[model samples]
Target: MTTMQLEIQAIAAVVAAACALPGVFLVLRRTAMLSDAISHTVLLGIVLAYFWVQDLASPALILGAAATGLLTVWLVELLVGTRLVKEDAAIGLVFPVLFSVAVILISRYARGVHLDVDAVLLGELAFAPFERLTLLGLDLPTALWVMGGILLLNLVVIGLFFKELKLATFDAGLAAALGFAPALVHYGLMALVSVTAVGAFDAVGSILVVALMITPAATAYLLTDDLRAMLGWSVGIGVASAISGYWLARALDGNIAGAMASMTGIFFVVGLLFAPERGLVAVAQRRMRQRWEFAQTLLAVHLLQHEGLPENRVESRVDHLVEHIRWQPVYAEQVIRYAERKGVVRRREGRLYLTDDGRRLAEQMVARA
Candidate 1:
């Protein structure tokens, strides 16, 4: 409604979208937790750079954060390569040490500065609009300019290297065999992620940055299998979360960053429950169908085996299935009705007989078995 409100929402949306771009690959590559590790460890870069330059606003801080992000990744990978610890264990081991060192440095040397762990971890987006930057003769929130630029950078990089990223992401061995340096692409992506995290973490905080990076991409992954569609969906979900989260915070008079993070979880739960093919409901329904179909196949095979045998009448009687095949009476009735509807079996004079198609299906199943 108000200008400040609009600016806050815009900044949040841009940050969310920017984070979501690389997040798609992170989710696809099964490295989503790296976002969390990088988000925390990058603080060490900022602290070190600030110590070196004694300036909070220096460009060196960004570079420092990016390098620290890459360092985090390299350290984790190095640990994993040794097989001494798994990827999760490596991330757990590396980020805490880096983040802890940064915290100690801030408390000891930078105690008088505005760089505090709480501010970096849980930023206040309501204050974001007050920090203005003049860009191209237009005054806007600094977060808007920074996150917007990062968003554009992500778009260009991902567009130019879409195929390479995709190939490397899905199959690194094949990508390397085809002359695409997957390792280079991987580090490049990590650098971009680090930059984006640094840009976003200042305004939205590390918690929201991690939430935006992983949640939207994960939610989109549940909704679609195509990489491009997943990217689009992830961006859309992020923007939606940002806008909706602003309103939620307004309604509850709560923290905007935390509200935005909560919205991402809400969207993910919705996707998990309702996504067309991969959702929990769909999976449950599919399993139920498979169970019924399998039961019908067993019924057909049983009938086919008893057809023309001395025990044909005894085994083929509809009620006899409960005892002969160990099916419950109620379940046996449901299976018979389902098979009848599918034309797999027919009940004639209370006896079950397999149709021609049912017999063929049974023979095929038998051959496979």
Candidate 2:
């Protein structure tokens, strides 16, 4: 891979892992949208960090940004729990105001600042590699180490506290009664979310980072009930989508961030349309096929039982043929036609006989089902 592709993939990997960690719990907690709020409001921390330390690489900036992320969570909680504001409403009222202030600060005070609002909102994955920031002479974007450390730390912490998080998320009252510090866990979660958002910002920008954090986990949730499987599958899908989307963007000469988000969406779309039980097309086709096969099975059973039934009698008398199965004649005929195409049944010499492949397939289906 080119350095640019490697850098983008590395950055995406970090962001994907970090997002997947809290995302599993976030979805379970019904706080999936909170990540969206944190992504937008981190600008306040970023702008303040820039102003206070005047150095982008300062630890103070990262801490400041994380602090602001936590503050945003606290503010939302205060609005929702204390003042009865719906969370979506509170989020709508809060982050935009904070973001507007950050924009104003950058525009007025840090006039000639390279911190563009466009980058703050949309982000630039393309330029993330050229920054070439490193620690101890290892050539890599600083974003990688920052997000990687956060990902590793969160993975360990969450793994240690996995049962606690499940209890706290599913039944906070029970968790509290069991001596789990639900409050402390909640606070820790929001803090980690803040840190994650801030760290991923430089590489993925804000929205794409948010997209990476939520979409894959959410998609996995639709396909799996186990938390561990969900997290693993989510990370797998995310990494695949990241790599695929990077190449797609390179192919089309398109925006990398947009391409990545599009790729994530594509995965979700595939999950929704092709998944075994829940996918739309899969469900429809399954029903269609089940009805078709049931009709074929019943027809075979009836013909086998009534070996002397004429083909004309069988074909023209689909209604009688399907009455036991209650199949619509049109549907029955169509299914029969489909079966015929499969070489399962032949209508010749005014009689029907099952082909060898058809009988074997039918026997296998009956045995399997």
Candidate 3:
């Protein structure tokens, strides 16, 4: 692969992982729209920071962006707590006000500065390679380093606070009762999300950033109930989507970030259809098998219920089933075979008798079902 393509892959990989991290908690807390809200309001932070720093590449940018995210969360919380504004209304109010302010700022002052909607909402990863850093005369794309740093920071923070995060997400009241400050953990995560968003925004833009973060995690959720497995699978899905999207974009000459997000979306569809145990196909097959077994078991029980005596039932077996139960001969034989295997019936002196386990189970089924 060319250096640019490699750098794009690396950048996407890191960005996708970061998006997935916050995405897990966001999805669980039912605050997924918060990411969307934060993504839009980030424009205000970028504009405000740019107005002060006069440059996009500065520490103030991330700090300002994180502050804006916190402000968005604060506003949402305040409105929600008031009961005057509904949840959706708070979300609706936060994004428009902040985004409008951002637009007004750019229109008023930065029109000639090239900080347009495209740069704010959808970043230019094509030019990422050209924007590089030299380490010992070996040049590296700025985005790759920025995203790698963000990934490492997220890893450390997540690792250190995994228990608290899980507790805060699953049971906030219990978490608080346990002397852990769920609020503090939540605020810290919000700040981390904002910082990750700002970093990713500069590389992949808002739409792809949110897509990469949420889709993989959402897809993984369908496959596993275990958090550790979900986290692992989510990250794996993100990386795979990044790689596949890169190749697809290459073949079609398309936008890399957009393609990556599309790939993640597709991954979700595939998982929904094919995941085992809970997946559509698997569940259907299991239900079909279960229904067949249930029908056969019911037939055996019906025959045994009619026979009552073991000797009469076994002696009259093949003819008795066909006569009493309207089941075809072949179906009767199939049920007989199954019952014998299940220890539900046994042949003794050319007679069939229900075993202890079989009698108890059949009795319970008849009584309740």
Candidate 4:
């Protein structure tokens, strides 16, 4: 509606898209929690860099944060390599120490500066528009420029190294064998993630950075199996979340970053419940169909087995099938009805008989078994 509102939403959207790009690989690689780890530990890098430069606007801060992110990954991998602790445990052990050190340094030395814990965890997007940058003779929010550049960087890197990243992610051993240098690609990805996290940190904060980095990618994973499609879906969902979250925050008069994160969760829940092949509802329906089909198969097989036997008369009786097949009367009746509709069985004189198709079906199932 207004210029400031548009600027803020644009910044949020760019940040969301930037974070979502590397998130796809993170989700697939099962290293999603690393985003959370990097988001927090990068604060220490910022503090140390700031102490060196005595300037908050220095690019050294971004470089320092990226290095810290790589360090976090290296430490976690080192711990995991020992086979003593698992990956999750390693991350839990490493990030807190680094983040805590950052907190301590901020409280002790940078107390008079704007580097506070609240801003790092809960950034104010509404204020983002005030930090303007003049780029190519156009004035715009600094967050927009920063996140947009990061988004472009992500696109170029992913495009150029898509195959390498994919192979390394799905099968690192094969990738290395094929001379892809999976370890190098892995650290390269981590470096990109680090830069993206720090770029978004000023606009969305650390918590929302993790959310945008993981949630959209995870939600897209439920909706599709193709990696390229997943990346597109993730970016789309992230952008939608950013725009919708702005409106939600406006409606509730709430925090924009938190609202955006909440929207990502909402999208994920929707995908989890209703995705075509992998959703809960679809899975339940598939199971229910299988149950009915299985019951029908059993009924057909039972009728075929006793077709001409002396016990056929009693065993084929509709009422007697409950005891013969150990089915409840109600369940037996339902199975019989379903089989009849499928032209697999016929009923006459209270007896059940398999039709031509049902006999063929039973014979095949028996042969397979």
What lDDT would each prediction earn against the true structure?
Answer: 0.94, 0.79, 0.82, 0.94
Regions more than 4 Å wrong, model 2: 133-137, 285-369
- In the range 1-369, model 1's lDDT, one tens digit per residue, is 999999999999999999999999999998888989999999999999999999987779989999999999999999999998988999999999999999999999999798989999998889988888898999998879888999999999999999999999999999999999999999999999999999998878886799999999999999988999999999999999999999999999999989999999999999999999999999999999999999999999999888999999799998889998999999999999999999999888999888899999899998999
Off by over 4 Å in 4: 82-84, 308-311
Residue 274, model 3, lDDT: 93
Indicate the worst ten consecutive residues by lDDT in candidate 2: 309-318
- Choose the strongest candidate by TM-score: 4
Better of 2 and 3 by lDDT: 3
Residue pairs in steric clash, candidate 3? 314-352
Residues 1-369, model 4: lDDT tens digits? 999999999999999999999999999999999999999999999999999998997889999999999999999999999999998999999999999999999999998898888898888899999988999999998889888999999999999999999999999999999999988999999999999999999888998899999999999999999999999999999999999999999999999999999999999999999999999999999999899999999888888888899999898899898777788988888888989999999999898888999999999999999
Candidate 3 residue-wise lDDT, 228-278, digit = tens: 888889889998998898888889998888888889989998998898877
* Candidates arranged by lDDT, highest first: 4, 1, 3, 2
Q: Scored by Cα lDDT, where does model 3 land? A: 0.82
Candidate 2 structure quality by residue, lDDT tens digits, 280-346: 8978999988877777776665555444555546543445656755677687668778878877777
TM-score per candidate: 0.91, 0.78, 0.87, 0.95
| lDDT measured at residue 96 in model 1 versus the true structure, 0 to 100 | 98
